[model samples]
Target: MGRRKSHGSSKSKQHVTHQRQLSLAKRNEINALCEKLFVCEYAFHTALSINSAYVTQLWDNYVEISTILEKVKRLEEMKTESPKRSQGIGQFINWLKENGANLDGASVAEFPGYDLGLKAERNFQENELILRIPRGLIFSTHNAAPELIAILNDPLIQHMPQVALAIALLIERHKENSKWKPYLDILPTTYMTVLYMTAADMIELKGSPTLEAALKQCRNIARQYSYFNKVFQNNNNAVSAILRDVFTYERYW
Candidate 1:
């Protein structure tokens, strides 16, 4: 009886070891696949990025490609059917689309099984344009807040016509707050999250009494003025007009 019990324990240990080995092997294969995908994506997007100062300025797309690679690695061990994984992949897809547009000035080709961009589109892709994400905000680390992310990652605001407007809104929002300026610097390395948060910081600066107070004032003012809401909505013309008005207002001040 003791011999039988020992035999059973040994078998169990062997099974566990086999499972671990399988998992490790799978992970290594995933890493290799991700490397191949990254190179392909970078090559495809870089070709389209010509002539744009923003995209050309970066030279190499290692940062963006690495982010996608990291995300794929996380997905390798995850259950493909899990809702959380699906949502995460969805968000990552959006991040890619936006970054592609911001840098390449062209919409990224769709993912095989995911269609977040198609769902986000209001029309049949006529007026719809590429939605580029600010490189600084793309992270394989953690999820960012929705509002703060909207400053850089909002699907509704990243497209062609709206891209410039989004940048203006972000800039205005950042310039208003001195405390957040360090995060909002208009430098090449600024992450999109920092830009958006800093922009919010700037707008909040107007009502210096408190963070809450500043938020309230900005919301109230934006709500009161249709133009403000339009600008916030991030229409191309609205953003252009807002940019003009901002300069005009600055000149007077």
Candidate 2:
């Protein structure tokens, strides 16, 4: 009986060790894939000025890279049973207060159903300013890279605020040690927008009018991105900064 118990314990220990090894291996694989994706992204940006056909191929590669990145990010999020905001979030709120935001009666709180939300600390009268966020704290295309800003100022692209903002948001998102890092850290890594949903998820919305609208918006944004890619292909500065195929339906939504 003693021998049997000892053998069983050994087996259990081996099993646990195997699981840890598998987890480590998976993590290493993901890291390798992420590196490859970055390389692909760099190559795609470099090819933007070559030709339309080559650019299209590179764009497809970029889409694949993005899709894989999204999957890995989702997997990482799922592994965490209880997701908590980073310390940067608290700093961000403090920064907001210091930068002229007024948080008097309302405080940012975590609720059961609503994730992070504004809650009333006390009874408030009508028309009272519970919270005030300064305009400078807001992220917009106006603060995008100089190259992107120049492109946005173009007579043709200037009229398309949505496209311009989406591009700017993506550019800022990829920046290393960005000024908005604190706020960006608190932002969701994934969205429930129709653009990111799988076909099975879309099935839930079958026959809904909003689905058609979502599809239309996707096509319109893709068309706009394509037009801009062709028009700015000769501009090396703009083309180098521009991330092709990033203006996805998810980004627009």
Candidate 3:
């Protein structure tokens, strides 16, 4: 008798073909939405002056894309997701202790699938201080402003104190003998920001107005980045000199 024909391989092939088709369709839909975005973006870029209309149009586009993307999508691997535990954390703690910052009862601990978190070693009563970080440990705008005084007149730095502080951070991080090296070294490279979101992830937020806010923020940041890039390229000053070589949109974001 002839060996019985197995249908499993044929079914598997059919499943593979279906998935390919679905993936191709999804890609085409996403591409079309992106193209729409480009067209709206170009209109704004080329306009004589930006107005509410351009932003509204783009926002509408984001809403459309977000709505489509918010649909049920699925996939993930067994590989667990978690922020990396920095080796510098220990050194940072030691440095803080040496500097009179008290964290004697709290320790940095890693939880599975979560970022490095400070775990309380001992419970405390109300009104009691849980921990204390010295003023020197704080990288405040007060500390950042003096270093960026050269470009303080620039509108970006003048209006945006946060931008000034950010630049200050860049300078400190770049320094060989930076006092904040331990803190900076322990800082996670990734953040829970919209810039890091996958298209699918953005889709998950589709129904919410927060999606629009996130998109607007992204657009504004891109514009600021372009402006800064131009300034850094042409302007030669104390801040620009250092940043022109090292400042990057990725780092800025």
Candidate 4:
């Protein structure tokens, strides 16, 4: 081979080697980061479940959260049957204890609700809150370990959408109430997943331009608001109220 060709070939080989190393390193870093994030997310939701106040709200609007409860039950059952799956759950919790240090840890103070750390600049769009996901989602313990992963799996979340929709519609429908109005300011991360799932379902079912428009609008609205933390503020009462007023099984039935 000519000297110039040989030199180019050597450089190309080095570049390929470097690229491979970088890709491996990136994947490892992402995996580590995801583990920590799963913990933080799990801790927040776990905190949400423990508070009596939220539980009472859920009870009052029993129908709204019925789906969510079902999904949780399915997940709980999976954990019981599979030790490896359960171990993933444990690792997630440990990650929370370690990495969630910086987030607001005043679970007692935030009773019935907690914020996962997400910052949004002013006038962010609605779709920003809507999780980007592929259809037909399924989650095992590994994906469930991180909160984001769980959120990604939310559409496949089994039973949460009806309740989530009730909450969102309540906020949108009850535009007059000052207290309830703010809840609509941003969709919660959990609810955002539900919304995406719902939209995805609708897209698949009808493929209607109207539904497509609605999904697009919802995403745009989400972007304008920022992440769910600023908007939701853990208002279980708000959720309950929406569930009671807006959603009846008959409507879905």
Candidate 5:
């Protein structure tokens, strides 16, 4: 009999192609919506400035556009589904095992408030080892790209170790096939940090002693981001490309 074609591979290729097309279409739609939303926002602001009669209409349109933008964004994200918890965690566990990690009695579990919790599956005696992670497995500026490391070492940058590490992480996160993809995939998309909270959300913290501290912290971070943005803007290098997106307040928080 004649050789049979591999329909599985063909179908896989078709599926990938279809997904790409869908993603491109969604991106185009989002772009169009964003342009319209921008115009609406500008009109609303203009109306407010002159105290125009159409202020309410413009404001309503702006709100509607914002809602649609959010829905489109969510749809795009759903289409580009992140790796499942089991898949990402399983991959990390396999990697650890391959690297001679001693994760015998320890297992990952989901808690009520806490997202992921490390639990001891079995009873451990005194002085018994539960889990041991090798230093080599950790991601740091040391293991980052040579160009990135050079940037971090530059006197002009003058960033602390944590800042350098943060920049390195942002660069890696932007890469399509990053080695840390599995690990990064598990990170929370949105944090409950004060930096991310809306004004309405902040009202819940009224009468709290930490409210002032949180506001101060937010202002400090904004200043730092502005400083970093100007510093990197002057340097026209690959480092700037990475650091450009890294100095955002949201990223810092």
Candidate 6:
């Protein structure tokens, strides 16, 4: 990190009242966690490669993590239950076809161990079209901009198209008359992404750079969460106007 050039501004800053503010304790906690994560990385490279004591100490963390991984892996491999996601597949497929998708030869089905996928109902020649979605049916920041026009000037939405699309998806999902209801309804309540990993699960990546990457990502997300937490609380932009009242962070995620 480089030092910022002073532009003759006062060192002491004014604290403007906000409808929401990041809690001092949570801010401190995030700082502490980031420090600890960096320290772990520092400890990794602190000693020379020839240091036996260093290697031995790191090995203990490895063994602890490996035990949990093996148990989890074994349990998953042994599981026989293959739950088919049949909740709203029919409705979603019907909705897609009704709109503009070409699916005469393809249908969605759940295979064992594979949650859900498109299955061929009949043979098709090479390069034949099996599906086509209309522009109006596709979800993207471009299509969703009108609903979020009030926050278009906000830097986060301007810079992060993915975030904007995600917010739009959530907004639509909450509406009783959403066009994407059938599709969203069939989606899982949660996913197994790194965000879903627990702190203990993070330990499994101890010796890997992935651990640091995950930590950095978590801290970054936390900071952003605080920023948006304030935004949703204080501003009455399209996003804040409707979300501020019922916005649980989980849905935002």
For residues 1-253, could you state the per-residue lDDT of candidate 2 as single tens digits?
A: 0000000111112211011122555545545554454444323344434454553454455356556656544433322121354433575677678778898877666677555667799999998878888788787766544457556556545776765665565555444444554555456555555556554565565455465455444334444433443444335555334443222223323
Which candidate wins on TM-score? 3
Which structure among the candidates has the greatest lDDT? 3
Model 2 ranges off by over 4 Å? 1-87, 143-147, 153-156, 221-235, 242-253
- Model 6, TM vs. native: 0.64
lDDT of 3 by residue, 1-253 (tens): 0001111111112211011223546434533433443343434463544345654665665555444333312210112222234555676688889888988679887777886789999987888887898787788767543557777788988898777777777766544455665665556666778866765676677556576577766555555555665666578887676666444455566
Query: Which of candidates 2 and 3 is the stronger one according to lDDT?
Result: 3
Q: Estimate the overall C-alpha local distance difference test score of candidate 3.
A: 0.56
Tens digits of lDDT, candidate 6, 70-131? 34223222212212346557777889988888788898887777677889999999999988
Clashing pairs in 3: none
Name the regions of candidate 4 deviating beyond 4 angstroms.
1-200, 225-253
The global C-alpha lDDT for each of the candidates, from Candidate 1 onward, is 0.32, 0.49, 0.56, 0.29, 0.51, 0.54
Candidate 6's C-alpha runs over 4 A off are 1-85
lDDT of 1 at 138: 43
Query: 84-194, model 5: which lDDT tens digit per residue?
Result: 344446656666788777899997666677766688999999999899988876777676544575465565346466656666666665543555554554555555666
RMSD of 4: 25.8
Candidate 4 weakest ten by summed lDDT: 1-10
Clashes per candidate, residues 3 or more apart or on different chains: 12, 0, 0, 15, 0, 0
RMSD of each: 26.1, 15.4, 15.9, 25.8, 11.9, 14.3
Error of 1 at 249 (Å): 48
lDDT of 4 at 191: 36
Model 3 ranges off by over 4 Å? 1-56, 59-85, 203-207
Clashing pairs in 6: none
